[model samples]
Target: MDPGQGKKAVLNRSCRTNTSFLSFLCVYTIMKWALLSVWDKTGIVDLAQALIQHNFSIMSSGGTGTALAGAGIPFTEVSRYTGFPEMMDGRVKTLHPKVHGGLLGRRQIDDAIMAKYGINRIGLLVVNLYPFERMSRESLPLEKLIEYIDVGGPAMIRAAAKNFKDVAVVVDPSDYPEVVKTLSSNVGFSHEQRLIFAKKAFARTAAYDAAISNHLSNLDNTFPPILTLQFTNGRMLRYGENPHQQAAVYGTTGIAGAEPLQGKQMSYNNYLDVNAGTALLAEFEEPTAVIVKHNNPCGVSVGTDILEAYLSARDVDPVSAYGSVVSLNREVDKKLAEAIDSTFVEVVAAPSFTRDAVEAMRKKENMRVLILPERNTSDEVRTIDGGVLVQRTPAYQENWQVITDRDPTTDEMSALRIAWKVCKHTKSNTIIFADQKRTLGIGAGQMSRVDSAKIAIEKACAPLAGSAVASDAFLPFPDTLEVAAKAGATALVQPGGSIRDDEVIKAANRLNVAMVFTGVRYFRH
Candidate 1:
């Protein structure tokens, strides 16, 4: 071939390749058609109305179709287009070619195949899934729970998502209005908006299927097989556990179970301290009062009367107890009100309060006194990355018994029980010293177990001599037992765990003090 002819030929080939690539790019950029289906109808009517105004053909299945029809909107049935009925009690709807072909097709490239098969183009897909979490929580029958598992919804969503360059997908109800507004303002959603929506749709579908995957997959060692996570909208609090840091209250999915009555808005730290205070309250069968600060119990006491208990709990750390969050298992009476009059309290949460008692507490206008409406115990939560950790709250010890050489005299055992119960609510390594109806001293948030015991003895003042002591965990060394005994600790309760547990018992024996192993540790941290 001649050199000049070769050059011309090369230029022609380059132009043809450029034109082909440009055509592909243009076709990929242009999208047509839309599919709409949803289980939650909260804002579906408005979304459908907007789509109809925009001249986008709507296709829906089963209840979603019924919902659109009831709202006086017209939509194409997936069954009619696919030539298949929604078999098996409506579970088989939308799992068909007409629905998927529209969602997955590239309008320009797939026209030949679509034309031959008579399939429609789908440019947008908007879908929301059934509430399996809500269903399971309601104690739905096994069959009903299984039925709520969404099939067609996810398939269409995934198809549209995969073809995002030519398709837009919206999975959350919250995104409906925004997507509608953007699409309404322009001929189509911008590439930026489509990209954002596509990412969100995939995430929603992933989380949804993860829930299902965890559900059906059998567990060999994993007790739950599937871990369920439910989060209620978090409320911005006045502050975190501290006023300096910003905080928010992320409520549990068990929202109907929350019961806080008549209190100032809880801060970040307020809720933590209050939960500790309340969990301590659950431990006592009798009327009890517990005051806590920085996740540690400053004072706690069970008494025949509320005022006495409050006074005793307050006495444990009068200085640290200032502005403490307080909780009571029973109603707060006038006497308890009088005891708290001298100090600043962040909150006083109780099941109930007398009219006069409420009036008395109101004297301190700045004080937050809340009444929790729920009388029963429930789970407490701790959040971690990507998932949450939960546990059934340790309830009142109904079966607590003395299991040691020094059997607690009925009276001493009662006091020890109250002290140990409250100790768990304190941040660990924890120690509490009390006698009869009031906390004499408290030591909380220590690094070493023995140090906590020493702090409790120092705080107890003279009361340390005869007061009973509660150790959140066992005396790892016999020295802690010796220290408590020297400080005048008489009766003791602890969850024993040291290898030389017998040595600690021997130390208690030598001191002539009674010791009981609770077999439960109350570690708040």
Candidate 2:
């Protein structure tokens, strides 16, 4: 096998059987031996201690080995076991004979693999992949992204996972305590337990591989289907959208386990509403806040600060804000916390929160505070009746195009672009009211465009007197634009290809409102 093309791997035949459930954790009292190599070390120290307590010998590579040594815990270095020092800018570790053979070999000595590589033992492998997703999302240069791919880690995990009967693999930190419990119950975890873990290991590896493929491949490469179909063993809600339906809360990659810091056990519909609110709020850069009800935003606002934004959005329609799922682009602060605490909000999602803010929120015994590790609006997905709707993302892409007979003035052009961007994010039959680089109001999903315009006006009741308006599609009639002008909108934006483009433009001219035609239509449906 060529080193340049990745090492060839072989697995010994299965020769082990499983044990019946001993306890919630099939505690194995003894550990024979193990190998560990990881990138993120969340509970590695405790895990290593647990293995040591069980009388297991350890072999590790690089920083992990060094860490164990610093703690006065003895370990066989990967170099000492494989007889090959980690080289190539520290890229070639644990890729040699002894490592793979041990994980992939059955207890009964197999001559085929040994004859090819002269190798023998790894009973268990604990590996967590390099931070590829974290690296890709960073504001890093190309070189950093190149350094994050884990070559040896995934390969070894796959090899051990393929020979599951002979190996125990742990890819997630959360699995450590359970693994330790099972090991302690029985002298050793049986073949079945290992096999179950092996399946999970392979799935984890597949997810990592798919993320890499999608990130590297360009649009024209005809990318493969890669959406995370992850749903951890979270709580089953009382019911779904209504008592007549059924539903469950499914989480995505990186985020695991449902731990609502403050709230009653979340109902299925509550989770859905919270997810929609948080996802929509994440779309803007400003100190934006969104309140969602039944997968639609009842109110949204952007301001220089979070408190003002949340208050403005909340004040839009207090009647609708009741039990609303609220989300903010910025950290939840004291003022915002106080405002939220004084209400009947069901959930509050934000990137983070101050200590005082959290304490304030705790006053509401049933309000949930979800701290989103990362603001994730770059990519999105949704499933429909026939199939899923996939795209680069519908995430408010900046508009740089202009289509109008008379060129808009510089100020009008900037406002048009901003308003257009916000309108694109609002639901179809959309109308967005904007001024001063912030969204004043948004009306979405109306049957008639005129009604949508009216909703936007109603939402921005006070500010409606002097803001600009944006529409996702052509009005097809003059009435809509005339209403927008009547609402004191200073400018208008639409796709502008309707046969009655003349009528719309005429209304714009009559109202002295600067107008633009994007030529591209953006319908959320």
Candidate 3:
């Protein structure tokens, strides 16, 4: 055969037949074509073989074609099938009409157009996006990173996804086996399956674009012209904060470290409490433990050992610690596990759990044991009506000025620092009382600072005498100082920027309390 005739023959063999066929039988007897172009070649070979076994032809481009060829699987290149050579450094390979028409052409609505342009309906499309996330993480040149931004991939995916009623779009290799199994059963994909795949495909593209937009926004030193926030739904919780509400957990960069090792399904409240407890515990370098309930830390402490830390923290407010979320900065050992097992905690989060610890935790079937990877210090976001509030995470303070005439003793300073760290994570209008690196009491989310101080004093399980009290914000009046002094609080740490600072200082001096001004307020609402 002549060269031109040979190329036409190959095209006809791979795509649609030029011969006329009755319209009724076209849907069943027409050759099925699967377009495969993916950056992730995880299960492509097996998928291709399965497709070939099901009498479907494979059409791929660039790296996908190379992968199929190397796997000894025959595949028609998109450039060859389209009769258009790839241009612009292989950017224009799959952008041609023939490639898209095969994916988007409708069997019933676009039959005339298909016959006019020799367009073959694509039955399946397997496409995964480029490594934009990985490339953006690397310290690469701008031009280099931009090169990895996929254009044709997203276009093809969207085209196929839009025609999902007649086309199946596969973006995850994990779904390849199911797709193959369906095809093997001679049933192919049902409409529902196609819709599911289409939804995932659209989400994949949306996340990819969001990553690009966020990267550019960071470089421009301004929010993107349109802010695009992307998140992957990590899991479906049992319920939202309340049982009547529906909720799911999502991760911004991926929930790398927050994997549950053993337990029942995590509820929305469990997730919130665990996050709060772990984030607070992450601020400490020593063996620390934090107990959180209703998104507020009830107790926090640092000790020579994990068991001691957990015990000291739990002792602060044993009643509040019941059914709370506990987080440890270090791994959970046998002793710590046994101690935790004694309590009715909803969740326990730590860097790791020893075998003995896991065994002990397993005994508590209702308790959730989470093996946190590493603490993520990303931006904090809260959704409001019709908008979102984004802000940098509060940094841990290491130094504070002692504004009082008398400096805190070394022991008092240690307690003050620990209380300060815990106070930063507490809700606004918060007061924390600590002694010897152990929390004596914590009052959070009160309407008034004075009330918070009173509540802290009332909630103290241990004596407040000689304890250091840390306030989340400046005290507007001397009432809070007087309350703390009456409760035997000897040392105090606060932002100290209120208009009545002079009065507050006078009250502190008269009460014989050593107070320090941090100059920075930590108000968490």
Candidate 4:
């Protein structure tokens, strides 16, 4: 026998001996290809190294490829593998059929077609979109901002996610360790794991698109034709407003997104009260403290210092301040922390807490302590029967005018301003009675304006004889104004829009009550 013929005969005999072994070899090789193209290069190098250790080949492009090469990791550039040069400033690299076909191709059903097209099956995909949301907030021009909107990344992620049964997709770098762990497992990624990753991947793309849509629409109109909102970083609560309901909190910034630095988990009621308190606290730049209960401002005050503010606020309605969420605009010191901890507070939030202050708070381990940042307001949204309600207020100053014959005194004016700010955050029909430093009494969420005024007078811990009264809306009749005046309120503030405004003003003049009419109404239902 010839030498070459003998070698060929041996190869043919080995192939015929085990057809199952040949099929297994082919399947194993196809399942070891991973494509990683990410805007955030976090943990990519370590993931590539782990994949290499597990005998998987990596394909990458753009910044990801550059990162892998810098790390000395062997990877096939997407441009090289797809036989297509990355054009359009590296935007057209991964949008090719080869990359998507590899991600979307089925294992068994499309095996023949895939072989014919020379498309490799991508068993794993790791991709993250560009920083469109981050850049949209900058002062960049529209053209420059548009460049950060990624095209191919979302496409590949969607394709891989759609075929999650056969392809594993990862959009978050935080999941790299889990992916690596799964690769080392005997069974690899389970079906449940794949499904979870797929769901997260789809959500990521949806949120990215929503951000882009909202930013573009907001450029032209305050309210877009279609409104889109995306809330992430969710935390499950024990229960909602009531024990029978379910609830969760989702946000990335502001009070909605804040987590406790020390203490018990935040409940649904705790979150509502904290959110309300923080919004009210943001109104005063002075050392201010706000305490909220049942989504209403039970006590709010401004003072020369935080300790003084907190003491005045707490004393305004000490009974109602129990188990309330307290928010302070200034840092909490040891003395203020001790004062706050003396009560059964549910949550305490401040811009910062001194080391001694935090240590003092440790005595109340069950009270949540949050480092509250500057509160930012956006368009408010609420749910209705079948749809949602969106409300946006244009930036404007209040048009305040003296509606009564006698103008309010300087002290009364200062107190009226505080009352108006508190009234804007309170529930209507609401009445707020305040002195120069703190709220004396608050009546909120009442059905009748007269009843709210009566309740405010009845609940005052301090004297109402020299306090300023604030009504959230225009009094339809003079009955509410008369009630406030009869309760010893020296001055009053309300939006003057009712048809009986003249009658109310006359009643105020007759009762010797100083009244101011702010053109803007603050009905916070």
Question: Runs in model 4 with CA error above 4 Å?
Answer: 1-25, 28-31, 139-141, 184-187, 219-221
Better of 2 and 3 by lDDT: 3
List TM-scores for all candidates, in order: 0.70, 0.69, 0.92, 0.92
lDDT of 1 by residue, 124-225 (tens): 788888887567667666676888888888888889888888788898888888878876787677778788888887877887877666555522433365
- Residue 40's lDDT within candidate 2 is 83
TM-score of 3: 0.92
Model 4 C-alpha lDDT versus the unseen true structure: 0.88
Q: For candidate 2, give the lDDT of residue 65.
A: 79
Indicate the TM-score of model 1.
Answer: 0.70
The alpha-carbon lDDT assigned to residue 312 of candidate 3 equals 89
Residue 276, candidate 2: alpha-carbon lDDT: 65
| Per-residue lDDT over 107-208 for candidate 4, one digit per residue giving the tens place of the 0 to 100 score | 788876776666778889999889999998897999999999999989999999999999999999999999999888857788899999999999999999
lDDT of 3: 0.85
lDDT of each: 0.74, 0.73, 0.85, 0.88
Ten-residue segment with the worst summed lDDT in candidate 1?
Answer: 1-10
Q: Count backbone clashes in candidate 4.
A: 0
Superposed Cα deviation of residue 393, candidate 3 (Å): 3.6
- Model 4 residue pairs with clashes: none
TM-score of 2: 0.69
Misplaced by over 4 Å in model 1 are 1-36, 40-57, 67-73, 104-126, 135-145, 160-200, 223-268, 285-287, 303-312, 328-406, 476-478, 496-512, 523-525
